[model samples]
Target: MNIDISKEDFELAPGESVLIHTNEFIKVPNTLSACIYERYSVKSLGLMISPAHYMNPGYKGNIGLLAVNHSTVPIKLIPGIKICQLALFELTSEPLRPYEKQGGKYMDAKSASISKLHLDAEIQEFLKSKGVQKASDDMAKELGEYLMGHIRASAKRLADILRAEEESQKNG
Candidate 1:
């Protein structure tokens, strides 16, 4: 789900990973492409931005990030925070098919837009051939819920153990 950070800050729980986006709209020139990187300052806060980092030439959208909170505590993420860095590359030549031309679903997509993998040209073709059209969301959502449950449970257990240790130390 896309978090609208415009109104208020978002709190990311420990062991949680979320898709975030830079609120800024960007336009990449046909001659250039871009890559996204986690800023060191943000990384130091135990938030890691995973890859799929290549922003193709002609991509016009807000930058998206897969941010994971690795620390034991929750992290408050504010809007307009400098969470990631963008590095542009001047391509020797533009792709035969640019991001928009090649059916990249993310072109001009909003920040944290749900995956458009289903909209990929090849995938659409295969679905059409099979006369089958199904959202991959059901399985993906179930898996995400299951994994988040497991993570929350594990974090709770760890916190309990730490609290017990602290109590024991104080009593001793």
Candidate 2:
């Protein structure tokens, strides 16, 4: 895909989505363009891949695939399964400037990168003006402590509930 999608060996619940990163990094030739589609196997399992638009010729990166779980239950992706395809189409003529040549934002990506929407030219100037400043040591510590307190409380509550449920079953 033009952008990066990253996921692996995940149990996707119904209405949940996953990002699929290709194991192999491929380099498309300048003379061809491609589109990514899921094979029939995925469809049979009630999974549908979001169709990626034309993989621009001369792209050099791991293909990203976004899949949605539509089945009633959770589904785990199995490895070594041919889940999708890159259907390459020959161009009438070679492109004067290809993906890598023009320094596309996604060129030579090594991992599943989320949408680089912030990097677009339109909003960059505004974003720069409101750019993030480094947090002070005390400020950082205070924020971290606050968040951690909530995390610990939530975790303890869940643990207590589970323990009670187990005890109830044993007593019954």
- Residue lDDT tens for model 1, 17-107: 8887777788999899888888888888898987547888899987777889999999988876777778989989868987789767687
For each predicted model, how many residue pairs clash, with residues at least 3 apart or on different chains?
0, 0
* Candidate 1: residue pairs that collide: none
Query: Against the hidden true structure, what lDDT does model 2 obtain?
Result: 0.74
Q: For candidate 2, report its TM-score.
A: 0.66
Write down the lDDT of every candidate, Cα atoms only.
Answer: 0.80, 0.74
**Candidate 2 lDDT over residue span 47-74, tens digit each:** 8887664678899887666778989999
TM-score of each: 0.72, 0.66
**Residue 152 lDDT in candidate 1:** 83
Q: Which stretches of candidate 2 lie over 4 Å from their true place?
A: 1-9, 126-172
- What count of clashes does model 2 give? 0
